[model samples]
Target: MIYENDISYEIRGAIYSVYNNIGPGLLESIYESALDYELKKLGLKTKRQVVLPFHYCGDQLGSFRLDLLVNDKVIVEVKSVAELLPVHHKQLISYLKLSNFRLGILVNFNVNNINEGIFRKVNGL
Candidate 1:
């Protein structure tokens, strides 16, 4: 298992709180909104739909938006799928690398148990 930092731990708690209240089978947007609200309620700074610009050899490339950036440290990707696929994990990893963030949490809100749907991804860990 990868080591989890304090920010990641707090974000995990916030994710669990949202999952416990909201349950499952909801759309990704819904979970995103609720998790943003929950993270703020926990006194954590959060930015939603944040655009992360990519760069290549001093050239500006297109950017991708992140679902949530918590405390400017952890990237939180919300998904409401039947199950999390490798592509989903890869997506988060790409976001983490682009954003220069070390930790990311991918939460799928379509599972019977939230624990089974939570994934912690680390970049260069």
Candidate 2:
């Protein structure tokens, strides 16, 4: 068994619930919204469209919006595309690095099997 943090395990269960109900071929926003709802229903504190600002030389750069932040502990990046590329994984890693977060989940709701599409990434773990 793969050991995960409590929040990660809960987020995975929530994602499975959302994907099982909604299936595939939907837009990313659709999955984002649905997953957010499912996560909330599971009693996990969720924040959508959270802004993570970039910095350079102690200067504030632009920011990127995270799809969802669960319990302020895990970053959930939702995607509905043909496939998840390395860039997708990199993007999640970037978010974790920028926010100093330890865990992140990259979920692609475009696969026939949601389990095949879910990815868990850890920063400094």
Candidate 3:
């Protein structure tokens, strides 16, 4: 099985590819589409806007939409904001916990430097 770290590495490359080409200040949806396209071009499986079922005490509650799920192992949360807030990080963490996903990449593509805007979040699963 491919490890989460390995998948994350490829994902980082894809993110940079999209950022470098598209630059910043685009809508989150646009980045999402472009990143999805890039990942596919790299021969990686990606599911966009995936609906994750939410559960509560052994009951189905609602659902949360994941921006992108790559290779069925990594979650990619795309954002285009002036700055990434604490809530953005928390949102990815929550998705990781809820989905039991091992790794997640939270990317805010509205910064001058994409390196500073990308974050790798591990769920310790």
Q: Candidate 1 residues 1-125, lDDT tens each?
A: 32348878888888889888989988899999999998888888899999978888988888799999888788899999997889999999988887779999998989998889999999994
CA RMSD for every model? 3.0, 2.9, 0.8
List TM-score per model, in order.
0.92, 0.93, 0.97
Which candidate gets the maximum TM-score versus the true structure? 3
Global lDDT scores for all candidate models = 0.88, 0.89, 0.94
Collision count of model 1 = 0
* Worst 10 contiguous positions by lDDT, candidate 3: 1-10
Encode model 2's per-residue lDDT on 53-100: one tens digit a residue: 889789997888999998888899999999889999999998998899
Per-residue lDDT, model 1, residue 88, is: 98
Predicted candidate 1, C-alpha RMSD:
3.0
lDDT of 3: 0.94
lDDT of 1: 0.88
Candidate 1 accuracy as TM-score: 0.92
Clash count, predicted structure 3: 0
Off by over 4 Å in 3: none
